[model samples]
Target: MGDLSTTDRTRHRRLREQGRTGRQELFDVLGAGFVCHLGVIVDGAPMVVPTVYGFDSEHVYIHGSVASRSLTGEGRTVCVTVTHVDGLVLARSVFEHGVNYRSAVIYGVPRALEGEEKLEALRLLTEHTAPGQWEYARRPNRKELAATTILAISLEEASVKIRQGPPDDADDPHDVWAGVLPLSTTWQAPVTDPSAGHDVPDHVRRRAGTRIG
Candidate 1:
């Protein structure tokens, strides 16, 4: 409900003013977006892979192909990040120019899930991408489930940061105009499949013209 307890790893050092320790802020950032970049070390080299994710109160779940190098290994620590760019803050000085955004970074050792847990994680992932999608779509079969890999990363160690408002160089006099160019993603009209001769579902229709992430 308030600020989250910070650990050594999650402590803010650089840009301390921008760091946030609230657990709810972390949840909001994660919930606002569907994609995340998963950072890990594979074969002594650093690898960052972009993937879709879902989260509960305590854990974040990411899934991929069973043979994926990023998800196969167990007991491996990884970093997952979700970010939403809200706008561009144009400033009188280039050095002061920045972006309005919300972001979260989570650090934890990933654990592979099996059986019902795996299926449930997949459901969460789908629903996260599009609410009510899991119920509307067909459930995965045994063969499909067997070919997928799901990893759970704990949310115990994480950090959140948010930036907003007009440029900081408001006091600096400049001939050029300065302001925030706000940005947002919105769902367009639904494109129906040619094979499926049915109208868009009510749930899908409700998302039309709505802002996303």
Candidate 2:
């Protein structure tokens, strides 16, 4: 079974209470983004590093260089967070102005993967980042796999918060206009590198209109 008890570190806040706390909301927020900020502790010092991650129903997988001292060292726990800002809620009142966004914060211990599980985890990571790119690209070799360090964190302790639509203001008779300015990120045409000797493939060209994921 998946872990449903968040460490409380991922709980919702009053200001963002319009936020959602369901599992689907959490998964959507996390799955919609590829980058995550990983917070770790080293020698009594705390460090937050930005990295890419992939998640399944049970675990969130992260990979970094095998030589990374932070990942290979002693500490077992880490905090991973992914966020997406959908729009800017511009209110007449400065205090009422806010942002429309979806965010997920995950807290758990990093567990190492080995053998076949490692390969599958890597596949999940790659496919999660880009839908069809994994099958089109080259797969990893044994030596490459050995050189990478992958850790899986159970999805037990996590939370999701989301804010959407317009800003709210008390019925002040003389307040200026207030509403939400929708914001969205879309993909542009893929430009091939100079080194490319032939026309771009269908998969690369098909990325146009692909929303940020």
Candidate 3:
């Protein structure tokens, strides 16, 4: 895969060393996570929405209710951001303390998909979050499809930054010890609803103990 370009919007002017290169790095960061923050301008004001997103070779897809004003953003461009906190970087001094993380900021004009493409995008969204849920659960019907809107934003322009490793203040003369406190997310046991009375399916049950981004 080609390395992503560092354009005006994407170029990291500060903390240049922390900026990541290549499109594959972007894919890794996005593929490991299921949620994103969508930023847009709506009704002459700024609105940031927490939403689920999926990405493929060329685009990142976000969806919501057809009636959502934020989804139908007033302007052409929107920003989608995904971040994963890996650890806390403890330093000898508070000023040097930081977080170890992977983040991506994508900017593009969203194009609403339709018909079969929209359905495909929805499936992508489902499979991205829960690998086999699309096939395991009931698929969306016509009316449900009509009430949903999926927007695909191009991946052509995106900014990715990754910070890792131990504290940068390891050599500090201060007496306080510095280290990294790791953090992670993992899948818990699947719960069965009493009303449904259905046993846990293989696909859902298999996710237990799995680590997430």
Candidate 4:
């Protein structure tokens, strides 16, 4: 794929070395994570809300309660950020200590979805959160769907940044050790519901012992 088209706002002015211009890099950063911090203005104050998000090739979807103030407005500009910390970069000096991570920042005005589009967005959200849970579990009903709000933001304008490898304090001749302490997330054993007296579905079992993100 071609590099992502950059706008004035999306341009990487600082830390140009860490900025990634590939469209596939942006998609990979977003796809690997399940949660995002949504930055928006609410009631004349800046609010950053942490929530789950799902994405297709062109758009990212976020859902919340119908009464949520952040989701009430249409055509309002919002910033979404997703980040994954891969490791802690320990260095000889305190100032050189840093984190190795992959992150994506998206800027767009979101639009509310209705009818079938809304329902499909919900499915995408579900499947993204838990890959096979959507088909294994019960689908939402009419009343349940009525109480939820879904917003779709175009992924046309976004930026990706990634940092990796050992600490950059090679110039410092300190005896202190410097290395990367890697981190990862994995799915533990399934915890069955007490009320549901049935065997765990094969789809659910398949995710156990697997790494997430």
Candidate 5:
């Protein structure tokens, strides 16, 4: 509920104006999407993998197969990032071109979860990506859970950055074109499988054509 405490790693040394300090700002950027890029070191090699995630007020959760190379270590530190590109900043000059976006970067030593918490985290992950599917689909069994590795990272050490609006080239004397090309994401129609043999539920139907980002 308090403003995000700034840490040495989170301090914005450049373009500080774009840096966001509010905890809700971090939530907004994260809640807008279900995917995040996770960075970690595997076998002394740096790896950045795109993965689906879930989060609560306190932690962000991600999972992988038990034998996943990136998920092999315990007590390993990681960096997770989520980003949404809102628009393109088109300026009169190429050097001034930029992107309008919302992003959050989290740093922490992730700890693997176990027992009921692990099951709950998987439910969170499934529902976060597909709102109604957790109860609609079959839950994971003991063998499935045993084959999965779920990790949770605290939200305490995180930072958000957002950039919006038109290009900042108004002051420059340029007769050329300059503007923002806005972008948005939306859910498309669902493609069904014949083997499923059922009508789409309202919970799933309602989200079709809904907007995102």
Candidate 6:
């Protein structure tokens, strides 16, 4: 909301330090990761579930089964968070050790989309899962759409917080290795399903050529 701000909000949970309050910072954090942990109230209790999400300028979309209890109902809000762990920051002192990562938390009321918008939102979700694969895949039909549920969460009251590089120590210095050991996730060669002996297409092969994370 209000195009987001580079300054932290007065609200404690909404404030972000380490100079990472920009809208682009939040977007980059979200775009770099596909899975998000969605937090919301369910049946008067707190619940957090991991789900794949897509984004436009102002809204993040998540899809699930139509019978999902976590995403249903009206006028209810949810918090969705995306995080990417870049490396493990190991300091000489145990107390100074930490993690290097980027994370974004978005707070908004969930709105369910219908008809064509549902389909479009689903396309966004699919593309977010794997870029360029949405159009390359078959489109969902009416019955399929009806069976699925898509919810739109406005990108309001969001915050981006990140920690990177080596660990920080105040005064004590120990004689040990102190640096970051970067962590990375990559895709390997795709293994063909035994059931599909030869039906696998060339496009599928091409799609699996690169790593994603």
lDDT of 1 by residue, 110-145 (tens): 887999999988888889987898998888899989
For all candidates in order, the CA lDDT equals: 0.86, 0.78, 0.88, 0.87, 0.87, 0.75
TM-score of each: 0.93, 0.89, 0.95, 0.94, 0.95, 0.85
Q: Which is the better candidate, 2 or 3, if ranked by lDDT? A: 3
Q: Name the lDDT value of residue 139 in candidate 2.
A: 86
- State the lDDT of candidate 5 residue by residue for 1-213, as single tens digits: 788868998998887989999999999998999989998887788888889999999999998652278656667778999999999999877777999999999998888889999999988988998898998888888898898888889999999999998888787777788999999899988888878888988888888899877
- lDDT leaderboard ranking: 3, 5, 4, 1, 2, 6
Which lDDT value does model 4 have at 204?
84
Off by over 4 Å in 2: 1-3
Winner on lDDT (1 vs 3): 3
Tell me, what's the RMSD of every candidate?
1.8, 2.4, 1.6, 1.6, 1.5, 3.1
Q: What is model 4's C-alpha RMSD? A: 1.6
**Which residue ranges in model 6 land beyond 4 Å of their true spot?**
1-16, 197-213
Full-model lDDT, candidate 4: 0.87
**Model 3 ranges off by over 4 Å:** 71-75
Off by over 4 Å in 5: none
Task: Estimate candidate 1's RMSD in Å.
Answer: 1.8
Clash list (residue pairs), candidate 2: 3-156
lDDT of 2: 0.78
Ranking by TM-score: 5, 3, 4, 1, 2, 6
Question: Cα deviation of 127 in candidate 2 (Å)?
Answer: 1.1
Q: Report the Cα lDDT for candidate 5.
A: 0.87
